[model samples]
Target chain A: MSETRMPALSRRRVIVTAAQLGAASVASAFLARHAAATPESAKEWLGKLAKGEAKAGKVSIKAPEIAENGNNVPVTVAVESPMTAADYVKAVHVVADGNPNPGVASFFLTPACGKAEVQTRIRMATTQNIVAVAEMGDGSLWTATRQVKVTIGGCGG
Target chain B: MAADVKPRIKAPATAKKGETFEIKTLVTHEMESGQRKDADGKTIPRKIINAFHCKLNGREVFSAKIEPAVAANPYLSFFVRAEESGTYEFTWVDDDGSLYKAEHKIAVS
Candidate 1:
């Protein structure tokens, strides 16, 4: 009986993998032409901003755990930086994983800003993860993510 | 383009030298996301403020690249260090090449 169960589980896993591959192909095709945003597209955007892979640290995103309305959800991103000419945050890019368009906003900073923090409101199409990546003056990248449960969709009229 | 478009700013009128202070700004615009359909089921064209920046005197302090995922009547808050007394000029650039600006004066003691 144990041997039979093992074989069945392995067969199920193969089928699941095949299905995932099929879905991924379809997603990629849609991602190229459609204006809607997906996890893959969001990752691509982050990659462009970071100019490399971003490590998860030194950045924090402040957002509500639950949002009753997806129309306007407040989000704040803060990075740990000295804000000095020698060491400062260059920019912070934000993306919403479940929006029609994931490109939320990008804040460009200078040493005169005196802080590596910015706050803005965003529109969420559904419950999704908000990711922020901060680029440092030394070309290093840091990232953080937060999930918000959006009760209502925001893209529709 | 939307009507009644206006930019409002919130900044300290005075601050100590080398002090870091927060600046908040908001602009009135529909920010049509181009994802919505009209009664005839036609998609509305996207129109939004695409960029914003703040300059202290003649130097750049902060700027932002706005996107469609931003909410309507976009609001942003950032920080600035008061090195010396100067006028802060805030500018918002719209999709149709319209520029909206506002100014605030800060005194550093």
Candidate 2:
């Protein structure tokens, strides 16, 4: 009985050690904002800034369905705003659901741009939804989202 | 002085009148979030590029108010409809009172 218990105890120890190692590696990547790193973070950021009601319209986000590389993924966001002095897009926010940092970029625009559009490249940690929130000058909000599957090198080769 | 931060900007060399062109930009920054710790476990003060401004022909083309959530080495691409030939000026302001600037010329044909 004693001999059988020893083997079971050793196996359990090995499993615990391996689990700790994996967590340590991922922890290093997100040294700061450890608590904020989660799928809920993406929406929390939007809620903090936009608050209250947010509708999906006018905001269009363009991103690749399958990204060859997790790093430097190009994203474009466009809003159908007249971009006139009387009415225009005030700001736009980009969020990636699966990255260590969910909020990616925020763009501020003026009427002189002649169009309410922004394009930027971002990093993706894994397969997740990319959301965009557009704020119109009149205090209304619009949003759009797209899913992207990131493939690591060699695996897809 | 330039070693503090460098601004990289890409603008079209030439474009047809009324053509909407894209401008890509990036700045070298660590984007320290203050929540980080040093080797000694000391808290590092948060410093980031809080503002980005772009102007074409003395007109404000695109501008952004960067928040702390933005990733490091902020990269942004925006568009402006070409009305005339002029230079596009970019300015980035850091939280530590550091200012990085760059300019690109665009010829409107």
Candidate 3:
């Protein structure tokens, strides 16, 4: 399987290169069209209140590097929290950068939840970064991101 | 209408009085996004579990707003601090105002 895929990737690269040289090709056209399909930035889903303030820490995102099918990409997010009354995660948000809608899922939590972790499957239209944001009770935000490559578009289309 | 949408939940049976434990869930549903057509060539009305909430006794601890982009069999894993001995009630709300519920009991030792 590995040997068969190597040549296919290089061939795709060659075709992309040819298309990049002002040659009208179907592959480039599809690329351009599908690329535009992803309009909303992941930041837009993150909310304006957190701009330039969130840092990457105490968060772990689990997602596949290459998803053969984009229909059901299993993703998990875990954050470091004791789930104590005084120090806990208030909410968690998941976003996909390349999907038509960046917002994937939102989870709200309270101190009664002892741990800060969420797992779910999401639809991905293309290869893109999946982001997980955790908002702490102390008004601090943390994030983690992972890239997943999709071979087939998911979303039942 | 989606019927008998089975829900699976795993939570701690016992925990320290002030300790936190994990809750894992998998709710099976087709999550028909209303974009697809049926064999009769008519669009299938959207039916999905749009919201989920976990409560300890009468206190809400965790909740989620699910989206159409979420995949089928919506799997979720989360954590909650076990403050006292009580039953953790989980409810999944379907788009059509139906609810699926599951519960687990934990004893704070």
Candidate 4:
């Protein structure tokens, strides 16, 4: 009985090693492909903005701790400013870190708003951080972010 | 307005000078998440309204960035203090860089 158990244990070990190697190869290939594509896409989107690029700060993003429905999630962004013509929030950009298209939305504001807050609802593909970047009239950037746990997959990614 | 555009906004038609009021807005859009598949199994391209901005008397007071995770027909409500009698402008920008603007004038006495 002991001799028979030895053979079975050895066979299991071999199988496990084979599976681990196969998984590692697959992961490496995926990483290589993603590495080749990500930077180009990021550059394309960032270049389209007026400032050519945005730094993180100046904007605040609000989202729930947990979302029951991934299809519809509520999000809000507020920027601190005087709302005066001389110095006001020029625009705000929302980006979803794990979403297929990271560049989410851009809002352009003027001095007539009298406040610096906006609220809306959006869809999240998975659990990830939502980032908000605000561009002010003085050509400076500010940012705020929130991490939301999405229970059900909405984007189907 | 584009044939594909649906815009909706709600704010006080009138308010007193130096008073605060709430404004609400919603736009009808598909807000494709780019991760979904149609019945045919093709990936849906991500398209969403990326930003919303509001102006009072041609001055901006509030703005936000939108994302694909935002639910369809995005709803936004916020407050603004009316400084003088003038028009409040609301603009929603889409991912394609199109702008949808609406205006409401307030009378201050």
DockQ of each: 0.69, 0.37, 0.59, 0.45
- Model 2: residue B100 alpha-carbon error in angstroms: 1.2
What TM-score, computed on C-alpha atoms, does each candidate reach?
Answer: 0.86, 0.70, 0.79, 0.69
How big a share of the true inter-chain contacts is recovered in candidate 2? 0.53
Better of 2 and 4 by TM-score: 2
Better of 3 and 4 by lDDT: 3
Superposed Cα RMSD, model 4: 7.5
* Residue B74, model 3: Cα distance from true site in angstroms: 0.9
Better of 1 and 2 by lDDT: 1
Q: List the residue pairs that clash in candidate 1.
A: none
User: lDDT per residue, candidate 4, B38-68, as tens digits?
Assistant: 8897878878777777776766677766656
Across B23-92, the per-residue lDDT of candidate 2 in tens digits comes to 8899888766554567887877778788898987777778887755455677888878778898898999
State the lDDT of candidate 1 residue by residue for B1-109, as single tens digits: 5469988999899999989999999999888898888999799999989999899888888999999889999999999888999899999999999899999999999
User: Per-residue CA lDDT of candidate 4, range A83-114, in tens?
Assistant: 78899887766666655566666767766666
Q: By DockQ, who's the top model here?
A: 1
Candidate 2: residue A2 Cα off by (Å)? 25
lDDT scores of the candidates, listed in order: 0.90, 0.77, 0.81, 0.72
Rank order (by TM-score, best first): 1, 3, 2, 4
State the lDDT of candidate 1 residue by residue for A43-157, as single tens digits: 9988876698899999999999999898899999999998999999999999998887779999999999888889999999888899999999999999999999999868876
The list of candidate 1 runs beyond 4 A from truth reads A1-35, B1-3
Off by over 4 Å in 3: A1-40, A48-52, B35-43
